[model samples]
Target: MQERIPRRTLLAGLGAGLVLPAAARAGDLAAAGWASARGGEGGRTLRVTTLAPDGPGSFRAAVEAAGPRKVVFDVVGVIDLGRKSIRIREPFLTVAGETAPSPGITFIRGGIQVESHDVVLRHLRVRAGRDGAPDRSGWEVDGITCWKAHDVIVDHCSIAWATDENLSASGPRFDGGDTVEAWRQGTSRRITFSNNIVSEGLSHASHVKGEHSKGTLIHDNATEVLIVGNLYAHNLERNQLFKGAVHAVSVNNLVYDPGTRAMHYALNAPEWEGRAWQVGQLALVGNVIKGGASTRPDLPFLIVEGQGDLDLYARDNRAAYADGRPMPELRVLPTTPLPKVRRLARPPLWPKGLKALPASAVEASVLATAGARPWDRDAIDLRVLRQVKDGTGRVIDDEKEVGGYPK
Candidate 1:
């Protein structure tokens, strides 16, 4: 008779061999140009300049020169204040017959481009030229772009002001044509972006393209994003009007402010279709939002707009209005456990010596967080489920149930 390998036993065997001592694995991975799996110390740090002889252009050259593997851009404390104002001499010539408008900076030719892996961009300030043009045109070049890269990090950078709302001479009416053409195309994955500021950068007047921009984490862009505490303000018109497919995770992010009028609004316009088809499950928790002063408003603390069914789980969110009037309806739902759906019917075996456990293991764990087991009833917060008239309502105890809380 063949020996029956217990599932747990098989898992332990697979998981055992791959577990390497942290120090040894760290050294090996580091030498191989891979990030330290254990987040170890003693790694090489490469610094590159983003301006001047060793500026953004030079930085690109340096990356090509240094070759890839465990590199850091070290862009902290780099500011370009030399060019006080970027004046467009022939503004009238660009837009003939119409009123000539002044834009601060102009990128007539090639824009900025970047290609690297495991990169970090920090502490850089990019703004509109100080000519006081009606439109604050900052950098005429294509905005900071990353191409064919993975595990990239963009932090503490500021991008604001741009040339024409619409790049074409036709003006802002026909979708900011000039602005639309400015975006660069590339493939990026596993990106972590935080504490950066972006404001007045892309004009609301431009038309946008590219449908494959995916897998991004946009958070803590408070300064130029304008709202406050990682809020996303400005570009409301363009954000609302854009139609593209973006797969991203937005968490603990503020979307608006009170002094600026209302509290919160959708990141995208209702007309736009972002992540319409391939939107993954979104987890929105602990978000605070306020609505505009308008009598009829569309402001919601959490708005997941797009196609496809979204298994969205929102908890501990506050949504209030400016008016003293009481809220008519607050749409809150009870936590419901999702049915298990495996990406692959059969579990993939771990590489030899890799872990192999019951296929349902991770799923069972995730379901617990969603209030799955009978014991989870005590853990579920009723405040997030139903709105009761009084804090202490009558407690009804019937036959004990064996499912999600409140069963």
Candidate 2:
């Protein structure tokens, strides 16, 4: 699932949702960075009255409605997508899963993709399993992803069982841009992926690329992406990857049992063979990564792979093994070639009024408040959290391994 639309094309297609109010409320942004901008404020209320994927009063209908809208839900249960996804094309929208009755809402066998601007998604669960699709059958689904979408905030969501990434912000690498700044503006910008539980991306399940289990991919040219206070558990690799020319921040995140790698940066030579190479900038602060049963030995806290130059600022990041043994902070595998890593004196893009918790406090803080409706967690979420605490889980090939969805 790629979004290849050029920047100009996307701008030309903007509709009534682009006409947003001038002043945004302070509460809308609180902890999020540039993405703190308001979404659907002073807009119409559209209630999701059914668990259907489409038709009247369904989630699809509410999201597809024109203009700025705030989506509230009266229904609470698992919304079986029947193996399809809900693409949010309308802008200035807020899907507040917290507005639903008791149990809240969960989407099974499908996912959500944000392709518009000024969107806020909160307190939702998305478990996009393979649904018995054949191995390598191209049945790829992301829990929630944003592409060519800006000013978006996806917070406190429980996302799992995806054949692809559990959560990500991605788009075209370069959309006919003459300079580096133009390239960044062409893709997703000002996005916040905060306080989410991204886990168990299905390995060897349904992606066309075999054995691809990833947590998040902040693709090339994506700018101003803030990944904070999230719990990334049981994904094989790409606990989060910053591709070429991207600007991102990873702070106060708890990563457990990442198989081969934890956090990495790469820019493939083939992807930018003839184009001008743009440098990626990243800030890593107060984060924690712990190796578990599935993790390989001597894994670095941060790995720079393939081609491309990167400017990085690292401070107070910590790593440990399953049994509480400390690990190297910047150790790389002996055979792996390193990319050009330039050190920065200070953070280039820190969020406003953001005070990162100490690395020692990351695990407790993330586990307690991360994911959708932390007060009312489901069986699968509780199981994953327990495994992370006890060091007892590995990446799986199917949701059946953990007992499929709830009845």
**TM-score of each model, in listed order:** 0.40, 0.91
Tens-digit per-residue lDDT, 148-215, candidate 2? 88999998799999999889998887775778777788889999998889999999998999897899
Which is the leading candidate under TM-score?
A: 2
Give one digit per residue, the lDDT tens place, for model 1 in 228-303. Answer: 1122222222211111222233333332222222122122323322312322333333333333322235434433
Question: Runs in model 1 with CA error above 4 Å?
Answer: 1-64, 68-114, 128-142, 162-186, 202-229, 237-247, 257-279, 290-296, 302-306, 319-407
Q: Which ten residues in a row have the lowest lDDT in candidate 2?
A: 16-25
TM-score of 2: 0.91
CA lDDT of every candidate: 0.26, 0.83
Q: CA lDDT of 66 in candidate 1? A: 40
Cα-based lDDT at residue 387, candidate 2: 84
